[model samples]
Target: MDPDLPSSSLAVVLVRARNPLNVGAAARAMSNFGVKDLRVVGDYLQPLEAARSAIDAAPVLASAQAFSSVAEAIADCTLVYGTTALGDRDLHHPVDVLRDAPSHVRQNPGRTAILFGSEKTGLSNDELSHCHRLLTIPMARGGVSMNLGQAVAVCLYELHRDAPAQRNLPEPAAAATADDLDRFESLLRETLTAAEYDRRFPGNMGANETRELVRRLGLTSADTTVWMGMLRQVLWKLRQAGR
Candidate 1:
């Protein structure tokens, strides 16, 4: 994929990054691959200011946004993925090796956020909870981790390597934004509650589980609208019967 192909839809998010040099390298990689949107979660002002001095990375760093939380950083995105090194930690999201992730990303046709964790510790479980899936770069040895800058470069190369030379057809409808999906989930929860499904199926009512289920549907903009309408109607009918 050429940088032009997915640049508009792809965003790079760094969580709790503490090193200015690594941050600079990550920005350079973004420039090399053509992705321009860079979002940093947590306190990043010092590092971000220093990173602006990196070679050819000034533009990317200049436009970067510092967000307080991952959710806020990715709010406008329709798909969210976190990078992980499969350690002993138990995981709730689907995992994809780096080689296979770009295809899935391309299929979504919406704004997508790819998150990188801090140097000392990868994303916490709480941080990972917001991601729809996890992506890992396969390594020959277990327990070995790449430098934050290298990881960013590798992932960008893979994502930008498979682009067609030219595009000739109309683009497909974009997927629903994360913000819109959040609303859909809320409405669906209300409908399920109105139908007493939550009481009957307590095991399935976990907030994270419900969120994953909605994301798995891969709903487009039109699909989200229709689904929301259907849920609203169901909720109204259930209330009417109760009255």
Candidate 2:
């Protein structure tokens, strides 16, 4: 993983992933490739919590963002690719084999999102419509399908495999970041303390670890403000209960 490039402009978006184990596995893959951004499009929040609980999952999973829809999830991304195994369904968008897709992904200097559908159904036609293109991992047999977790790992590996040479391409626009992530960290710490999480799980995670967790979220300045507000509200409610 190249610390300098950091792949800050790249995000992995999971759509309606029903299995918590698969979510955790996908996050672990993102961690392996140094892709810090992970977005999930689903109404259920349990998978996110379960994934975060995985012992092997990195801070990437911990900071993963949730959205109610694919459009909302990929809103910040300038380019979007949907992954598919290729079946009887008609694919409207151009398809790129997994290995060759990385070049096009690197072509965009803005944020790029790769969407992975659920373990059972794969991406629906409506979902695929939002994608600029589709990516498929070549299989040994025409009909064999890859597991959701394994597919994520393979795509991430392909994206990261050629990073050194791809860096020569135009640099992506600077990603929006929180006020150095300090303000968000401070608010988060205060909220955690108010909720007595620190007392209950003493030394479970330290101040530095908390800071790193917030940093990994890769929130823009606007996102930080929203988080700050939410934390403050939580703190207010906690204090009210203590009264």
Q: What overall lDDT, based on C-alpha atoms, would model 1 receive against the true structure?
A: 0.88
The global Cα lDDT (0 to 1) of model 2 is: 0.83
Q: Judged by lDDT, which candidate is best?
A: 1
- List candidate 1 stretches off by more than 4 Å: 1-4, 53-56, 164-243
Per-candidate Cα lDDT values, in order, are 0.88, 0.83
Per-residue alpha-carbon lDDT of candidate 2 for residues 143-228, written as tens digits (9 for 90 to 100): 45789899999988888875676437875545446564777788788888988899998675597788778778877666677778
lDDT of 2 at 237: 96
In the range 158-242, model 1's lDDT, one tens digit per residue, is: 8887766455787788999999999999999988988999999988989998999999999998899999999999899999999
Number of clashes in every candidate structure? 3, 0
Q: Which pairs in model 2 have colliding backbones?
A: none
Q: After superposition, how far is residue 162 of candidate 1 from its true place, in Å?
A: 1.2
What stretches of model 2 exceed 4 Å from their correct place?
A: 1-6, 164-243
TM-scores, all candidates, are 0.64, 0.64
